[model samples]
Target: MPSAPTPALPQTTCKSLDDWNEPTHARRIYGNTWYVGTCGISVVLIATPQGHVLIDSAPEKASVAVRQNILSLGVRLVDIKTILLTHEHHDHMGGLASMQEATGAKVLSRANVVDVLKSGKNDRRDPQFNELAGFDPIVNVHAFEDSSAIKIGSTQIQHIPMSGHAPGGSGWTWQECEKGVCKNLVFADSLGSISDDSYRYSAPDSLANALRESSQRVAKTACDILITGHGTASDLLARLDGAKPLLEPQACVNYAQAGALRLEDRLKKEAVK
Candidate 1:
């Protein structure tokens, strides 16, 4: 007898691209940390009495809404004295030129990323450079070494280099306090092995080794709350809805492990090809 016919899988429809830039009301993530980016991207504001530190600026098109989000939080854009980045992708740093021009905030990131930021050009080292566009140039960018501490008022942000997603990709760790208790907040870089059709994880120039080491470091890092470059990756919305605990001690480890598995799978497919 013939085998049973295979059942068709459910078809998935692409979500509306407009939803990516739609203005979502800003909300406090925890303590002084607030979410101010779009529904698709992750931008965080860490408020300090002296000033404020913003992480990532979304794309240029959505920057105005991001600024509005900040204003809605009762924090002046001028009060943003420091701007840190998770990576130098156009989607992440596209608005740096506008935001920095408006606030004159000191931009900080890994040295290589700073170069890319200043040039407003895609870094050749990036695996997807040919498929990506450059953003507005940001002048006088400063470099921060891995594990360096950046202090703004009472808040301290530690930079951790995780260079696999992007050559200068990095993550941030900080402590937010409320009611005499503090929680460690981690903003991890994009960890998925995403690329255009022509790109391969098995390419000689791929930063697979660096990415593996970075994933290991992230797995070992202590985290109470985890935030990622994209909201969906870390379930930022579900957590905000009170359905999930604010403090997830093992979140980073899980994130790293998942990323590692993705890398392994990509390499396996490449080997077969």
Candidate 2:
């Protein structure tokens, strides 16, 4: 039987986007720590004492809505010190350049994402990448080879490299909540489903191995909350026995593999039909 869904909190945004609604289903898992994000789509903003850090940017059209929400909170756009790119896809990096121009926030992404955005050399010819390619030169991008620590007020984030989503895909771990009680890890993409855009590229086989390895590592972490790219912050640890956790990129490859297998079976059944 399927598990019941968690009730979402009341959504409040500064600006409205007719295309997408504010995330009304966000849950406050730990005290002073809420998943101010939506299932399957969102640009998660973490408020720390040091400054604000955005996980990803929403689509081009939704940027205004996001900016309004931040301003509504009485937070200046300039206070946002970092805009982390989860991937190079337009949905994830859509308002990157604009946000940077408006707030002077530094952009951090995997080297591959930077390369693709700068060079447009990837095999996939999706228009989103092209759009990102155009923004590459305008934005100030800083590349991190592996894991790094970012301190924001009371929150301490550990940025871990879990490539596959992007050559430099990463997840973040919040050491302790503001209330000083709960500790959570934002798996970012390490233990989550692939974004819809992964369909554009023929995901390499090595990506699966990377995800499997990353999942195993994530499974061993002390995180109580796992924020994925899509879907909800699952109690994955609570149901590890029945669940199969794969990293962000590995999960993409697995998802593609599963689709291929399903298609083959469908073809067999349809031939008989």
Candidate 3:
């Protein structure tokens, strides 16, 4: 099949991070997992006996809120033992450097993302590199590979690579137990094929295929509760309110399938153009 021509990168209008910083109260989504991010982005906290593990740092400007949200939950910033990332996107990791410095927590992410994180630069392959601003650089990050398990106290987090949206796009799966009831939770990465109008998923060297494959892999995980990088994608607010069931055995699969469909549709549109 002939690949579509790679479109020129566009200079999309950049929106203020403030616009995305609508304060969202932190709450326990389930077991030890807490939602500490803003209304638009998602930052999760998993507490253990030793300390806490934080996932995704939101944007830099919004990090103060993230910190306050954690404090509001009665957790001390110094007790945050580890910081994990979903990917190297600014929205997800912009606050990491500051958070790491404040808490002195070890940072972990996929090996592929180390350079980008350290350099505070977007990968040239990213569609929105021109539009997105670089974040503060992080140093001495511990890198892991696919299916690697990290154990802290009694909590074990499995790292799953879900590349395409970014080279190091990843997910984390862990079992949380509360009152003798345990649930397998998966914090899946952003699955949407989002890009500037100048980018094409159908391009010859596009990450489309890897994205689809990773999405499918995430779907196969045993997920009792599913959350994503974006709060709306998983109905995080509703779920936290107890209006939604905690055990959604099919949530992971369904989310992956829907993302695949959206990507397929996007490719079709590009073919016609």
Candidate 4:
């Protein structure tokens, strides 16, 4: 791994929950860890007794800043043992190259995604913009199919298969955090279609039906937290109605939204017919 010439972190004031009032890219949680946000992405850094497990590394530009933010919470780069990629999207896996070089940490993501990442790089006409970022945090990767389980120290991670957003889309469930604290299932960018509440989509009916099924499968699981690949963490317990499952998979919401849109289209067609 090559090292970035410039230092990743500069001298900065200690950052913590007391300093939450201050504008920072990270926020301290209950455990001895921090949640750092990058662009529309966010990652969880766990300070386990064994070492550290970072959910996802941000873009190369944000890697140094993220490192500084984490150190502010009392963790060092050398302590990071593993970097996990939810998928191979640039926003989610962007800063991996820089972080790996600086910390010499192992990178992990789905095997199928590596193929996509490689294909993007080889396309001469339209090279994958992600590789050009100079943050290839994934030189070495551990590929797994759907529902595969992996371990990092005391952490037991189960990678759930999610498709549409990317071929090898997946999520992780952390069995234990520092001090035996069990965190919720971390779904990496499981959202297949339908953007956030900014605009309506015009997807075909067949696509909408498929999305609904995807959501149904995802929402069936029981978890406390829903971590979106785009940096939003939703507490499923609070969002759930008595009838709905809490911490449903990302597919649940993505499909529901698309289904609603498709339903409207069907009703309109019926009216015309």
Over the stretch 1-273, how does candidate 4's per-residue lDDT look in tens digits?
111223443323334322212224455432443566443456678667677878777665567767776666666788888877765655667677777777777766666566555443322111122233333425655556667776756567676665444444566655434378554654544444433332222333223343344445455544445556553234321232223444344544553355445545654654564
lDDT of each: 0.82, 0.52, 0.82, 0.53
Candidate ranking (lDDT, best to worst): 3, 1, 4, 2
For model 3 the local lDDT of residue 86 reads: 86
For candidate 3, the TM-score is 0.90
Q: What number of clashing residue pairs does each candidate have, in the order they appear?
A: 0, 6, 0, 6
Model 2 residue 248 CA deviation (Å) reads 19
Q: On residues 1-273, what C-alpha lDDT tens digit does candidate 3 reach at each position?
A: 111112432212214223457666676777878888877788999988888899999988888988987877778899998999888888888999999988899998788778888889987788666677899999868888777898997779998888878778889999977799989999999888888778889999988998899888888899999988886788766676676876788999999998899889989999999
What lDDT score goes with residue 47 in model 2?
Answer: 62
* Model 1 worst lDDT window (10 residues): 1-10
lDDT of 1 by residue, 128-204 (tens): 87788888889868887777999876678988889988888999999987799988899999787877677777888
RMSD of each: 10.7, 8.9, 10.5, 8.8
Scored against the true structure, residue 259 in model 2 reaches a CA lDDT of: 37
Model 4 clash tally, residue pairs: 6
TM agreement with the true structure for every prediction: 0.90, 0.63, 0.90, 0.64
